[model samples]
Target: MTLPGLDLPALQPWFTAAVPGSGELRAELVHGGRSNLTYRLTDGTDTWVLRRPPLGALNPSAHDMGREYRVVAALAGTDVPVAPAVARCDDPAVLGVPFTVVGWVDGRVVRTADELDTLSAAEVQRCAFGLVEVLGRLHAVDPAAIGLADYGRAQGYLGRQIRRWNDQWARIATRDLPDIDTLHARLARTCPPEAGASIVHGDFRIDNTILDPADPGIVRALVDWEMATLGDPLADLGLHLAYADPAFDPVLGGKAAATSPRMPGREALARHYATATGRDPDALVEGLAFYVGLGYFKAAVIAEGIHARHVRGESVGRGYELVGGAVAPLAAAGIAALDGSG
Candidate 1:
């Protein structure tokens, strides 16, 4: 039952030695994500997923697969809605780098806001509630149980974020954005003290979630644990706001128009999370600005890297043409807000 694409002769021994039916494994690429190379593997009747680093990226962390596996495995019995991790293969010879396989749950990715249009109002509300509740559960987990006691620094996390992304921009940026440096310095100067430490989803967004098609209210799995870290939980909330901010005119980037269907409005989502977590909404606003600035600054750095790659004839994808188009203005706005300008 080994799939046609995989090298059965080479993988047969390792597959057989690892799992009961590993010998019959077959795998096919699962398209949709840009970060990790994911594949769906099947052994006759049983199915699983394999995740690994992209083919030729200069990633600093060689153990991402192991890290993701460990994070998901540690939350196995918890309220977090994560796919079950089955096994991890760190031997580079097996797949050229570390990779992990997990049980493949059935669900559909919420890609665009139009997809939300098909759901009932109640389903939409439930999805919003479910997302917040799962995040709350993650933040509430005891990091000690997962051996992530040193996952991230609890104090001055915000200050560190401003500095880290600004430094990253200096390393990766190829073009001049008018105000990124000014904004970063100002944000750093005004950064408030650490609010509290909790597990933060560094890049939480609608596309990162898989929703049950039958019960749209339920989030079947929270994918992409690469950025999961120990930091201010409110930072995650702020990132969500930055992605879904309706105040920004969507006509310029079309991101807002595209997102209208997938995620709940920012106000509604904030209300839901606040009620569930018992956080005061008014008191969280100042922290929100810090996180928003951090989110946009980080995004701009990532986009600039992609744009630089494309400029150097190193990019392989189609959609990267829009990298600088969408990020530059947002980065400018972020800098403006930080500088106390309109």
Candidate 2:
């Protein structure tokens, strides 16, 4: 069977040459990912996961394979748990697009509330705190020590993020959303200074992580690094919180695991993160609303982008129809966050 975005016949020879002793390969698309296309590849004896850009990407940087490969490769020995980077193919002739292969992680991903339901209340709380601890640890890592000091420009990160997302809104918006513009203007005017720079996971949430099958409290691996960069760590926290909003439900086609009633609230997670990193609680409170608002802004743009791709028939998985409904609600939430009413 021919897989979309993967030419198995062309890939077999390259895989053999790249990783000796690997046998014939078979690929299966891993659903649920809305941006990049992920495939589970096995040669009967060995297994690996491949990630590449979507069928027709609107922004190359948003789905960069090389950037993802570089960050994951650099953080191999760090406290942050990540999949073993096996090989990277930058030559487009081989796969018709750049791609990266990592050893398949043996764990489970809880994306929707149905998946989270399998875990007990105690386990859910443990998992939530574990995720927060991991994020704190990630922000605490010294980028220079990890050879990622040049990963991104940390100065004026918030301003640049606003501009980037605003541009993205212009490109992917299906309709005029006045709240999005209002949110953008507010973020521009109230943009906070960098709350110290670190290696920020552009997207840090439960679904993006792989948890140990037997122990939900342990994170086996952190996948999806296409947006990893050095930036205000608070921005990462804000986005994480934004995903907890019920408004984000439609984007995932159902209730998100992050929004599970069993999980910790935004304040508890934020406090735990601050405690884990030895950050001042008062200081975090002072600037958190802006970051949360910014998170909503980013999420809205991303949802719109996915909807745009789906409308063009470029999206690879199910649930694309539900994503567009999230954009306006997310924008309204962002405005509320800034106004201190969310």
Best by TM-score: 2
The sequence of per-residue lDDT tens digits that candidate 1 reaches over residues 206-262 is 667788888865778888787677888888876766666433322113343224645
**Which runs in model 1 stand beyond 4 Å of their true positions?**
1-13, 59-63, 245-258, 309-318, 336-342
Q: How well does each candidate superpose onto the true structure, as a TM-score?
A: 0.85, 0.98
Q: Write the per-residue lDDT of candidate 2 for residues 64-179, one digit (tens) a residue.
A: 89889999999899999999999999998987889999999999999999899999989998999999899998998888998988999999899999999999898878899999
175 Cα displacement, candidate 1 (Å): 1.9
Best by lDDT: 2
CA displacement after TM-score superposition, residue 327 of candidate 1 (Å): 2.0
Superposed Cα deviation of residue 206, candidate 2 (Å): 0.3
> Lowest-scoring 10 consecutive residues by lDDT in candidate 1?
249-258
